[model samples]
Target: MKILITGGAGFVGQALRRALGNAHTLTILDTAPAPADLGPSTRWIEASILDEAALREAFAGQQAVFHLAAALGVRACQEREDIVEQVNVGGMRAVIAAAVATPSVEHLLFTSSSEIYGDGEPGQIFREQDEPAPRSAYARSKIASEELMAAAAASPEGARLSYTVFRLFNAYGPGQRADFVIPAFCRAALQGEAPVVHGDGLQTRTFTFIDDIAAAMVSALDARAPAKAAGSLEVFNLVSEETLTIASLAQLVCLSAGERPRVLHRDHEDPAVGRSKRFEVTRRVADNRKARAALGFRPTTPLSEGVRRTLDSVRAGSGAAEARG
Candidate 1:
């Protein structure tokens, strides 16, 4: 397949590039260029997703376009709401429009977020059928983008475009930004600094491995699934069934680093943080059954193993700490 991936410099994009390099003709478009060591088979184009002309040019001759570019990171999104909205929602609109305009683009895979199910009622595993109740600005923006993509796919112009929207949940592994929980904890613990545990550290999350996510994306691309049927959009939640609390993860980080650091909760005056959270992921876990039947999708990496691999990568890329502010 001739594939075009946006945000190809980002963690997930890098993983996909490595996984699909030999099997497909890949063209990556992003606001920044990829690393110098990127494979020869992968072509890089530096362009913003909001640039419709650039996106159109990138979409030309592409069989599938993975729309992964977006303003990400909880801290970044919380600080820059306008920029996040513009780049995430507006940029997604541009990508969908460009795909609709290009006849050869058969599939457009959009990476959505599990944040849309924000703070569900206790013990409710976020199912695909639940109505979205977004809490943060970032979550709202993602919901808007998902709606936009669904609308575009239902239009006459988008009749031929195949859409696969995956609502990914807490994907972690090497190459993840330092601002993220896993990488932040790994970097701090590796540097002999105490891993910062925000609030009381009881917030829970499901951390999916980057490799499993890439594999799921490939499966979705190759599956015979309809983007929408019966006036509703088809969506899949890509996440691990395993759940871990922030405190537990911090302890694990300390263990992985061969050091036990004291957990320091932020001061009450430092803005209230770490709201207790969980997602009703029941249907999401069940949807894997559908993926398995249709696409032969299966998550192979366990959390402990994935964390060990992430720690190893952090050790190898210790220079990343210098890049941190």
Candidate 2:
């Protein structure tokens, strides 16, 4: 299939490339420059998601599009609220329009975040049916984007839209940015510095490996697998059952990096200064049964192994961009 991935140069996007590049003709539509080693079948187009002409050009002859472009990360969203709505919300609209306008386009798989279910209690379980409590502008923008796609499909442009929403929990692996928890812990461990834990160290999250995330995404391409609701619109949580506390992950990273992890607990008055994203949830565990039955979505990589791999990759690419991946 011919495919286009917005924000295709970023970490998760790169993972998708590694997963699906061999089988499909891939075109990357992103404002960022192309990566060094995009294969022969893959091409890069320098454009933002907000550009309709650019998106239309890229969407041409494409059978599917993975909408990964956005103001990523909680901090970036919190810091840039005005632009987040413009990009996250407006960008989805542009992508949908481009897809609808294009004759060949059939499927669109959006990579939404777990942050859409914000402010859950400690060890709280999250399901797709839960009402979204978006605490930040970022999560709210994602909610709006999901709604936009659903509403658009129910409209006149209903037939060609094969839309799926994946609410991805904490995905960690090689080439992750330092702003993320795994990379930060690994970097601190490598440098023998104290890793900071925002709020209580007991806060837990399910961290799925980047490779597993990519695999789940690739499997989502099987249009027969997703829910047959609303004429094939599906929403699934892409996450692992492996849950760990923030402090525990830090300690694991330290051990993996050959250092004894000393976790420093800090409760700050300003949430922006804290490592935790502003108004973020304390715990989020995904229900992956739907993904497993629908898309054969399974994450096999162990957390300890994933941490080791991330540490090695980060150490090798220390001078690269921060908080990306």
Candidate 3:
């Protein structure tokens, strides 16, 4: 199969590339320069998703499309909602238009965030059918994009396009940017700095490993098409069973690095801290039973083991850079 992945240079994109291996002819479309080590079966297109011409060109002759490009991160999106809307929503519109026009494209996979669940009460599990309570700009953008995907699939022009939406939970692992919680904690622990805990440190999230995310994404390619003759739209909650508090996650990272757990609690809205946004979701845990039954998705990594591996990878990467220098 020939696959075209938007934002293929990102953290999750690189992981998916590894999972794809040499099985598929891969084309990566991103603004970033192509990775020096990309496989022979892979080619890179340096462009933005908002470029309709570029999207059409990339979608040409492709059997599948993985739409991963977007303006990510809560704080970043909050600060620049306009850009978020432009990239997230506008990009999806462009991708759909291109896919609808393309003849060879069969399936399109979209990565939606679990942040759309908003602030759920403790023990409240988010299901696929649950109404979205998006609190932030980024979350709202994702929900909007999701609606666009469904609408596009049901459109007459998109009758042949099959689409899948994977509502991804907090995905953390090596190569994740430091702005994220897990990698931030790991970096602080490795640098001998106290991990910063925003708010009360009780905000909960279901952290899925990057490998599991990649595997589930790759498995979707083999999934059966929707029975509907016009088109098909499927939504699955892609997450692991592990749920942990922010403070607890910090402690786990410290322990993984063989360091004492010393955390620095700060107001999420504090400008001095200059990271987290004012509005933060209290709890977000998704029910993955539908995904388990439909896609045979079972996340295998435990929180402790995943944390250890992430820390080790960071250390190894730093050591390799030092050696090269």
Instruction: Give the alpha-carbon lDDT of every model.
Output: 0.77, 0.84, 0.88
lDDT-based ranking: 3, 2, 1
- Identify the runs in model 1 with alpha carbons over 4 angstroms from their true place: 225-233, 267-290, 319-325
List the candidate numbers ranked by TM-score, top first.
Answer: 3, 2, 1
lDDT of the structure predicted as candidate 2: 0.84
Judging by lDDT against the true structure, name the best candidate. 3
Q: lDDT per residue, candidate 2, 249-323, as tens digits?
A: 888888888897679877755565554445756778868888889888888998988888898898887655443
Number of the top candidate by TM-score?
3
Q: How well is each residue in 1-325 modelled by candidate 1, as lDDT tens digits?
A: 8899999888888888877858888989998967788776778889998877788778999988888998986556877999998999889888888887877888888888887876745566776677887767788888998889789768877867767778888899987876787888888888787877766677677788999988888876667333433233467877777787777887788788887855656633355543222312222222355555655666788988888888888887886656783
Root-mean-square deviation (CA) per prediction:
3.8, 3.1, 1.6
TM-score of 1: 0.88
